[model samples]
Target: MTRSGTDRRLSDDEMASWLPLIRLVQLLPQALDRTLREEGGINHAHYAILVTLAQDAEAPPTLGEIARIAGLSRSRLSHALDALARRGWVERTSCSTDKRTGSAVLTEAGRDMVRRAAPAHVAQIRALVLERLSDDERETLTHLLGKLLPGIESAV
Candidate 1:
């Protein structure tokens, strides 16, 4: 049998590393989304936005900054913020530093939602991931993924 020039295949070691990560990446978000929606009445993306806003108590970052930190595109963040705003969880306002820019601020209701969701969300995460790992394994995984993120993010 002849192989095509473009038909590079995954080696066993690569598959061993990548296959599980691929499955986790694909399914974990859905699981988290479901849990957050059921327990907190919000999906994961909206939850992420709320968390981003909660990071700074005194002032909010601009939309672009939130996009960078949350790993969301501008449009996605905007839409999520819109949903949150409609729910009285988030409010977008003109940035004080840059009037042309906008920032998202978490409302009291939003902070309460995050507080309510955190315990369940954390439990779900532990059930799905952390419980399966030894502490050392978890630390190693975090180190490895931190090293991997820059390359992956740059490609996007």
Candidate 2:
């Protein structure tokens, strides 16, 4: 079938192709959330925030920066940080350069928590996602995803 113009709507095959990706995106987060919540008393987003702080070169990042990196709103991030702080998993410190700005640091306990949670998280990811792909498919998917990333970043 041909459209009147060059711009065409998605074909059935194209739509079908996206179904797996869409389902994966939806289910993976839920699965991860369930696993983390059960095992670590933290949701996937919380785990991600802690891991991001742990991986940061400074071992801490400004709340604003953390919110940006975490793709969460400042208010939402603040709430999450508050929860984490209450759980004793993270510490907020006044920035040396800017007293008004605060940084969130993963505590020793947080580090240990993340370290413990990591293996199960990695295993789950591998089992659900990576292990399903053949080596060639993995390489191709990585390359294609890398190529698409710049455009996504630019759009954002």
Candidate 3:
């Protein structure tokens, strides 16, 4: 069922409500990617993969799991893993439980890289985003985002 032309257009309040989120979705990833590529010699996607492995209970995670968590396709994740492996940031080992599955392990070097990258990343985040918000605004933003996250995850 299609709406009439007037109804199809976004309402002013709807535009106002969603514009910031749309801008954020467009800009944040590009900014973060640029920063990580410049300072860490890795893109944001690669950083996410490493961080996911680092956060794993085993300090490593199966390739499929990492791909899912990172929201990347298997081929893209495989290519990123290959690059990380060449940099000595990650090591791939055949899973003991499932020979066909491979796991990516974060190396000491990778942990050190993440540590080095953290300060600059946090500074950039603070300067560009967090510093602009008041305490109450920050809390509200967090709460609102938290509320929205489950719905987004369910869609995915």
Highest-TM-score candidate: 1
Task: Give the alpha carbon lDDT tens digit for every residue of 17-74 in model 2.
Answer: 7888789779989999999988898898889899888985843578887886776778
Off by more than 4 A, model 3: 1-7
Assess each prediction's global lDDT (C-alpha) against the native. Answer: 0.88, 0.86, 0.86
Worst 10 residues of 1 by lDDT: 1-10
lDDT of 3 by residue, 1-156 (tens): 443677867777778868988999889989988898788988888988888878849435788889987778899999999999999999988888888988888999999999888788888889888999999999999999899988986786
Task: Tell me how far the alpha carbon of residue 21 in candidate 3 is from the true structure, in angstroms, after superposition.
Answer: 1.3
TM-score of 2: 0.82
Per-residue lDDT value at 149 in model 3: 84
lDDT of 1 by residue, 1-156 (tens): 444568689667767878998998989999999999899888887888888888856778889878877678999888878989999999889988789999978899999999999999999999999999999999999999899998998897
**For candidate 3, what is the lDDT?**
0.86
Separate clash counts for every candidate: 0, 0, 0
Q: What is the RMSD of candidate 3?
A: 3.5
TM-score to true structure, per model: 0.89, 0.82, 0.80
Order the candidates by TM-score, highest first.
1, 2, 3
- What's the residue-level lDDT of 44 in candidate 1? 84
